[model samples]
Target: MKLTALKTMAATVALGVSMAGAAFAADLRIAYTGYSTDNTFWIGVAKAAAARADEMGVELLDLTASSPDAAAQKDAVDRAINMGVDGIIIGSVDNRAFDASLDSAKRKGIPVVAVDTGIEHDHVSSLVQTDNLAAATIAGGYIVDQLDAGTVLILGGSAGHQTGNARRDGVKNAAEAAGHEVIFQICDWQDACAYETTVNFLQSNPDIKAIFSAWDPGALAAVSAASELGKLEDLVIVGFDGNPANLVSIEAGEQAATIKQDNTRMGAEAVSNLIGLIKGESVPAFTPIDGILITSDNVAEFK
Candidate 1:
């Protein structure tokens, strides 16, 4: 009986040591899947979030879709699940394409926080993004004031994506309500695609008075296309996401304006929310970061 007690005490000490080692080594392992790093906006996000993760002493697993590819994003989710992540924070490629993977994570009791886009699943515990509808409304209102009922070329992201669709609908709805016709040219938010599409559309509709891209890169592409045609001065070109490149264009009188999203803050806040969730704290269902309009009048401020 003394030998049995001794053996039991040894086993208990071993278990306690093992548990303490695990607690000391890895408090949590969280994963983050971002949008295309090709966009400088997302790059800013990644850098800021990584800094926050480091400060929190948490291991951040970074995964990003190259450029709004659902398959790639889904693969990333699978990898995160397979890694047994404590939680996942994702800026979904399409927001609607991760149903299966998210469902799998849910079954495994892994929580998810969405950033920059809304996934239509109850599994997502929190969402952090700009007020896209309000931002796009501002864009539309600006366009309405700048042009007098001329067709506005709506160059932007994939129409199926929630953030893309929200921006599109917000602008389209507002622009249409003001008696302006909107023709959507979805380009998956690719700069080259925006350039080519703008060139073709302008060739066919030289009367187009304004161009509004949902993101700044597309705006930059539109500016280049118009400048190449010696029509930069004639078009009212506006974009979202106040990238420095877009600000430079606005300064150069190529693009007219852009909306600046606080992407860095959004990224940091996502990490904060994830950490809070892990600590058994209730997080808000939605978190919003502010955005601003960057034109020649205020571009210098952002710069």
Candidate 2:
């Protein structure tokens, strides 16, 4: 009877431990979304975020919009809500179009973490991205240094897009304040559109000395356009977002310079903060990642 009692107690203890282990084994599910993957910037963000999610053993459901459409991202939020994701990480398409779905997510007790482009919603638990204005100010100042007295064209993203606008303001403010003539055009963040704009603008405004593309892909477009026009060496081309190709272009003498935003770090930090928030830890409302100005001088390091 004593042996039987001991055996029964051991069995009961094992059952309790097994039940506790089962309860702890439920893994977290995260839904990751981005506005566009057309640019290398977002591509880097996705890759880094995925790697971090894997490291954390979290199941990440990735989604993205092909274009800068708010509806797509909002729909993604809804889907994530329906799927009952534990948390959300998103790079918004626009600042204002996500509040409704985000609010819905809040209603379901799911926290949202915004990365890259910010959504102007109070419900976002945290934000991770580079300081756009300062980065672009550096790029714009570089452009001004290259040009003495000729018109400069700025290839910008969506009109009124907060991130793009900050970059635009930075470059324009620095360049104009330095006495360089500046003109602007919107490309909606499309590389092809930037290429066409550069080609067309250069034809009519051949005296333009330099171009500042808000993103690195747009800078590549400017490079292609200038090379085709046989004026590549004559014009100073500066791009934002130090993508791999941009670093290559800087090293290969195809492009002038770029503001290298640590996109991988941004994504990784987003995941980190989201996990912290899920664990009921305190995190900052806004997290800013610094950028590096990449020129031939330091392109080797980044490469």
Candidate 3:
């Protein structure tokens, strides 16, 4: 989908809903646990979810983890179930770590909606997230087409993570198919680690001509590393998660492009779907939101 259309849809979802006579919304309490509180992406999701919950007259508990701790996330879910919330929304740090907690919620008849990260559980009523593999393929194709020749470095999320693996493979597959050599590194979703790795790797490998980050912060970290090494203008940098800060970098020409996810829509849709489940209504099992690749050429539309 186009960037403009996605923004318009988010606005409509935010401003078009009627506040009066939301009978199903009354007395509804929803609990949401995000991937982490430190990331701007999750912050955006929390903000949108809170706004939508308010519009629908539902009480939302933002129980986002202070850091990327899978244990904390599971505990938060367990707490919400103990509180007897009508529904729950989760952006899990580790999707595989929630079975026990989610099972308890299921026994208590509490509905769940997984967002961003896919949780494989029977209790989850819906999944709302970006098509990460497809979006990363687009970013990789851009790198291959725009750069003449050189190795590409990929800074990815934690190993064995489903979403991270999909993104990593998407870019790796595209670049390798185009005959561009690719190098990979796991940043464990830490900006400091990404920065250090980029610096050390670039110091040893001058043949690297492009960088792809699985998330926005790592992209910014790469930009910083390249700048400090006087190689900022020599490399093409692209990142995932259309973070507002990353867009600023794109506008300044510090970065080339980023795949922007519909975080607002994901948050609102998760809440909406959970409410439907709470009301004994059916909602789609999976909700895939489109991502737009924002570059200096089209960054104005997003801003």
Model 3 Cα RMSD, 1 decimal: 8.8
TM-score of every prediction relative to native: 0.89, 0.89, 0.91
- Between prediction 2 and prediction 3, which has the larger TM-score? 3
| Residue-level error in angstroms, candidate 1, position 129 | 0.4
Ordered list by lDDT, greatest first: 3, 2, 1
Residue lDDT tens for model 2, 1-303: 999999999999999998774453247888898877776788889899989988877778888877667788889888999999889998887777877788898888898899977777778979898999888888888888878778889999887888999899999999889887788999988899999999999999977999999888899999999999999999999999889988999999989999989989999999889888887889988899997889999999987
Q: All candidates: CA RMSD in angstroms?
A: 6.7, 4.9, 8.8
| Whole-structure CA lDDT of model 1 | 0.87
Could you say which candidate leads in TM-score?
A: 3
- Please, what is the whole-model Cα lDDT of each candidate in the order they appear? 0.87, 0.87, 0.91
Cα lDDT tens digits for candidate 1, 1-303: 999999999999999998885574367888988887787999898888888888877889888876767789889999999999988999887787888998999999888999999999989989999999998888888888898768889987886888888888778888899988889988987889999999999899977889999888888889889989888888999999999988998898888888899999998999989888876789989998766878899888999
Candidate 1: count of backbone clashes, pairs at least 3 residues apart or interchain:
0
RMSD of 2: 4.9
Give candidate 3's TM-score: 0.91
Judged by whole-model lDDT over C-alpha atoms, candidate 2 comes out at 0.87
